[model samples]
Target: MVALILILVGCNSGKKGEAAAEQKNPKCKVETSLFGMTPEGDSVMLYTLKNEQDITVTITNYGGIITGIYIPDKNGKTTNITLGFDNLEQYLAGHPNFGALIGRYGNRIANARFSLDGETYTLAANNGNNSLHGGVKGFDDVTWVPEVISCDERAALRLSYLSVDGEEGYPGNLSVTVTYELLMDQLFITYEAECDKATVLNLTNHAYFNLAGEGSIRDHILYI
Candidate 1:
């Protein structure tokens, strides 16, 4: 069995700036190209990040979704180890959260409401009586602006989005950015966000992995 570790953080603060320092002799290559267009005529793009070690990941800005991940097995052969559609239509049509960046709240909120500062805020009941993943049109359903960052040792794609005040019944106008870095034998994902007002915020990357490179997880072992 393979173990996957996800780090999540939520913070409240004023505006902050971040910079990615470039490195020399970088071992990764990043490329971007047109993927498809949305019904609203918005153009979507596909980002490909490949490392010197033969690991590759493909992502799209449509939903900040990872379309595929390629890794080599013991025999020195490489294959995609994640499940996803072949094109944008399949993703736009509908599917589970498959390889998406989930937010403004990653999990469920009981009764679709939460209280803050002695005031109760109502949310969309997306799941039964609970609010799930920021309600019907969370971050996973929106397009994000993307920028490529490179360093001597790695290359990354930084995606940014702005969640307006009262969007999906959540308070505060939030500014969010998620970066996906590709390195030899590893992939690093980092998320940062700041809100203008007091609000509930949770974020996560939803990527289902099949370490064996295919089929059901019946043979995969689990921990925790």
Candidate 2:
């Protein structure tokens, strides 16, 4: 039987934007702590979500990154099933998207430029001639304000970020919110956003999972 399941919600906004097997009744829990401090002396926090099934997901405000995800196997053994660093320094140093929240534009814009209503805007071209994942800094590199919400059914961490106009060459001031919820044997993510002006916007979570607990997924079966 398969061991772990990682669900990622990638949200893309163009200006406007489940249950598991039965077991012992366990209450969902959420814990927050200081993850680290940025070079600019900003404090970053880590929020951990634990479900009734003992599955745990750790996320940090720095870049809105999912630092870790722990899931149990059929044998009742738990292990972290995602790739990431142990500290904020490593994340700041750089790595693949790991488990970052990509935004403004998730993919790319050709030539790092776009036109709207006969007006042209130029963006940062970190990915060759195209603008990749928002831009050089993107949403992945910014700090988000976090709010923890809990109820009888689940616990959630709601993170919010405001992208100002002219930032990364985007036209409008965008307000974004992403919530991560822990329920029975599952993780739910929700993303919402609004912009003051008409501007291009897209958002997504880049999380890589390893179901077997280690190694390449070459031997695993995928069903799209």
Which candidate number would show the highest TM-score if scored against the true structure?
1
Taking every candidate in turn, the Cα RMSD to the unseen true structure, in Å, is: 4.8, 6.5
Structure candidate 2, residue pairs in collision = 11-203
Residues 1-224 of candidate 1: C-alpha lDDT, one tens digit per residue: 22234444232221122222333545566777788999988888888887788788899998899999988888988878787888999998988888999999999999999999888899888999999988989899998987777555666777899999888899989999997777667677888899989998889988888887787879988666
Where is model 1 more than 4 Å wrong at Cα?
1-27
In model 2, which regions exceed 4 Å deviation?
1-26
Quote the positional error of residue 69 for candidate 1 in Å: 0.9
| Global lDDT of each candidate | 0.80, 0.79
